[model samples]
Target: MTEVLETTSGSSPRTRMNKRILTLAATGIGAAGIAFVVAGAIVFGDFGIAPDFSARLAAPSWAHWFGTDQFGHDMFARTVHGLNVSLWVGLIAATLSAFIALGLSVFATTCGRWADMLVSFLVDATMGLPHLVLLILISFALGGGTHAVIVAVATTHWPRLTRVLRAEILQLRHADFIVVSRRLGKSWWYIGRHHFLPHLLPQLLVGLVLLFPHAILHEAGLTFIGFGLEPTKPAIGVLLADSMRYLTAGNWWLGLYPGLSLLLLVLCFDAIGNGLRLLQDPRQAHR
Candidate 1:
């Protein structure tokens, strides 16, 4: 019963040109962001944990570009390491969130009315609460560590993506091919494996990438509030928290550089996600 829309034979010249421009822009931004992360990791990885008591509290100089912390550790190194940690956390958390969304979405669309209703209710309930508060509570309850932060981020971040996926799946459910599959006596699992899963890949990838910034920011926030990674770890939140007391004494570089670094990394992640979204659009690829 579903009506199918046919694609046009070709795009206009202007449209093709526009698509090429967008595709190029997206690819460049994504590649630049990825390169920055990799370069930072390789260059600063070794200096992360080493401390120099003789250089303690030293301001930024040729020897230490980002200055020394209260413990004489290189701020540049710590910031880079912290970024590496945040990226890893974001990657794992986003991947887990995507999987959760995919499962809930598939279940809601393919199962009976009661199952759909259950998923809908759960999504609504989660969205109703304050996201940060829920994340903080979850992290705190789990005893506040790296693992706790990852779990909190993964659990709190899935609702939006789940709703999006559910809508996508519902739309696909009524598609002509899906209707044909059902009439041919194909099982829900078979149809999902052969049709729905393939269709969902693009959305899943975009959603996963978009989740990175949120996960990194939230993890940093939680740590800042004393509900994230341990103080011993050189996390961005830990760095910021440590620098707070020194701010009154006019030691600006301690916090400023790390804060800027974190902001830059988050922006890079966002750009990469946006780029990937554009690249995934077939219409945008032709040009």
Candidate 2:
């Protein structure tokens, strides 16, 4: 009986190990799907070249997974390509915006009164303008497309980032370590890199993740309004826009799939940001 019990216990652990492996395998596939979306655009010419004309107008099934658009282009292919566009815009725009904010915050902390006043005035002026309108105007002025979308979104959101970073820096400026660093005759660069930056990192990282959702949504909005990535690029917004024309004719798949995909993608980034914030907050960790 003792030998039998040992065999049973050993089998139980093997079962648990197998379960864990299956769970990890599922997660790995999900991650691969995300990567495939981003890489599909560049690698397969947005998969536009391989679209099946016969698959066009087909409903979702075992064969044509996401169905087809009115033009017979595979919705699945377009959706994957759209992910590439969103990911690129979100990453580049968020980074550029964060840098702009960091620079402004540092300048406010280190620069004299006159410079601060000037920057303050500029930030306020930009803030006063309606953000979406400003983005459209900027995009139009810059002739629209990927680079324009990136710059427009980054610049428009930067004022808020700057304000937050500046406030954080101001709080740190009075800390004992900052006072000591100042007394030691350290340069601004040295002080910023070795002292202030580490303190600001937690907040900066949280802000970057939060900004990704915004950047992605803004890019989609611009595309929906015909000012973002070109029509040929197969971005989500463009797909939705194209579907709108045919929605009244009973082709719901065109708009429905892309819209759902966009919502989920945005929600994923938002969830990640919220999770990061909670993880960083010691008070929230145990609760």
Candidate 3:
């Protein structure tokens, strides 16, 4: 799909209005879907481990919409539970990562040249390693649970955002008002509170929104490989992994539905992030 109306968004006023409506609609849908997922998880709670052998390997039906897994667990319930776990972990991880970037950017730009150099070195060192490898190593080292996944993602995902925030903060730091404020003997806390926060908030917000997809995807990957969530948890990765064994036996619904759900969830996050970015851009915001 087209992104952000980067050029002339639409041919005419009517077209621009239509595009804006479309963007709003997509964003609303994404928000609603996320809310629904959270509500589903709350309603269903944990997926029951009590086996229903009679319904084992059942296909989709009105009673069990996404069908049953090998153990006769409701796939739909499990998928929702899994997604909920992912959502929580991703939100926490993305939030911490965004703030980490914000803090480092502040430190880098305001502390001194040596601080800036140190931050730059750290960013390069972190980004130089393979991303997935770094995630795995960190998760495994932390003993691989929800917290581990959060920490792994939070640590690995901040470098690019840090660079963005650092550049933005540095520019703002040298702006005429900032220079004047410094000359006027404004305290660091005062300038930061008054000047830095306003300028950095939007960039931080956008970075936080964009980080969700990566955090969620990496969480699933780690869990799928048996290094993230515990085996007993009803995580999407766990569902997908269990389905792999039975796919060849003609029980396709086990994997298909959950995989599609994950894809849809990720797409929703991407849509929201893109939508926010577009709205923040002056050209697209008016369109």
lDDT per residue as tens, model 2, 6-62: 586655555655655654454455446556666666676735545566667788777
lDDT of each: 0.86, 0.80, 0.88
TM-score of each predicted structure versus truth: 0.89, 0.83, 0.92
Candidate number with greatest TM-score: 3
254: Cα error in model 1, Å: 1.1
RMSD of each: 5.6, 7.8, 3.8
Which structure is stronger by TM-score: 1 or 3? 3
Q: Tell me the deviation in Å of residue 199 in model 3.
A: 1.6
- Listed per model in order, the count of residue pairs whose N, CA or C atoms clash below 3 Å is 0, 0, 0
Which 10 residues in a row give candidate 2 its minimum summed lDDT? Answer: 22-31
Sort order, lDDT high to low: 3, 1, 2
Pick by lDDT: 2 or 3, better one: 3
Encode model 3's per-residue lDDT on 1-287: one tens digit a residue. Answer: 34445344546666777888888788889989999999998888655455688888999999999999888898888888888889999999999999999888888877788998999999999999999999999999999988898999999999999999888887888899999999999976688778998988878888998899899889999999888888888889999888899999999998999889998899888888878877877877765
Once fitted onto the true fold, the runs of candidate 2 whose alpha carbons sit more than 4 angstroms away are 1-36, 39-48
